[model samples]
Target: MSSDPLPSFPFLNPGEFRSICSSFVNRVTGYSGDLRTLGWTNVKQDYQDGSAMLIISRIIDLPQWANGEQNDEGSCLQDDIEDDDPEMLIRPSSISGTSKVEMEYHILLSPTYQVPVLHFFFKNTLYSGPNALEIVYEHLVPPAYRSDLKQVGVMGGISMTNHPISGIPVYFIHPCNTASALQTVQGKEAPTAETYLPLWLGLIGNCVGLYIPKELFASLRNNSDD
Candidate 1:
């Protein structure tokens, strides 16, 4: 979260959804890397928890505003003194900090939900399982996607829940609009693929402040026609 260049989100079709996922990774604002495929329907990517997926940008020189925000500096100093790691020089005069927090994200196909489930995990990062979920709620997942109304037996909202397959805690966001859009493929009278899936994904991207180009509409249109 303290990274200089922060990140953003978005996606989908049946076969067309695959193409949308590809575009999202390559066309995202401030990022232009290819995501590696993990399975037939899963795309995997990593982002620096504090930077651009690898490096951590530390606040070498503390700012005045930060002083007020981190008013517990005295306690932090005491803790630092207790640790006494010489490599971590934490003093009033100078503080050289390093953080290499990395996180991996997955857009997984959910056969049950009939949509893609947004899931992510952090390694060597400050956020724990629940903390990561909160970050996704506050920074990544949109409010509308969350619902207090239980669909089956569970609650809604971005949840830090366990992935059914891996049994690991992760930040998860549900794709609420995927069902109706996918229905179009079955010859159902629902929103066209071009009209919904890419737009929904683009909204996800925009929520994360990613620049999903308007040209995406053109592509979505092309796919829907087929």
Candidate 2:
């Protein structure tokens, strides 16, 4: 390994982001389970400025409870959600069991925050609307994170905004406080390139229902031992 100093905690330069994306994708591909289960791919846009984004597009069956199939009282989310409270923005929406949901996640380097920002786009088999955010809130976000996400400033909570690269409306976890969150998770010491992306995915990805399988880490350990 090169002795070059690691980038500051929670922040990665563009070059570092590309390098880590490749390493992270390769590590996940080594997973023993079906590769499609993890659904991670490293994609670099061939625009004038080559930019890479870690992409994961997958279809998930909403929980039975959220689908309003089990219980009589269906989800109370509205078709259009206004950002009245950045902290608590989810309202009841009409989503049925037949609605197919395909969620696409993009992890890109944020020039302003110097950290990776997770931008997610939701495509519904029925229709796409503000209710998409409701699906994320009700299905993807954990009960523990739902409350903290309301503290937008402190937690760098979830918000809907235009994607920087695509300029399309999408939901993303705010990256402003990412450095602070990583510090708490990773401790005071800086992590190397090999370790940084994994640590980051654990913190940020978990918020939106993305997870790195334990098998990936097991493979990493086995490789190091060899």
* TM values, all candidates: 0.40, 0.74
* Superposition TM-score, candidate 2 onto the true structure: 0.74
In model 2, residue pairs whose N, Cα or C atoms come closer than 3 Å (at least 3 residues apart or on different chains), thus clashing, are 76-92, 76-93, 77-91, 77-92, 77-93, 78-92, 78-93
**Could you give candidate 1's per-residue lDDT for residues 51-154 as a string of tens digits?**
11111111111212211212233233234334445533322333344333334555555556645665555433323434234444444334544343124112
Q: Which ten contiguous residues of candidate 1 have the minimum total lDDT?
A: 51-60
lDDT of each: 0.38, 0.65
> Per-residue CA lDDT of candidate 2, range 75-134, in tens?
222211232333233333554445335667888888999898998865432222454566
Q: What is the alpha-carbon lDDT of model 2 when measured against the actual structure?
A: 0.65
Instruction: Locate the minimum summed-lDDT window of 10 residues in model 2.
Output: 74-83
What are the runs in model 2 whose C-alpha is more than 4 Å off?
A: 1-5, 38-48, 63-100, 124-127, 224-226
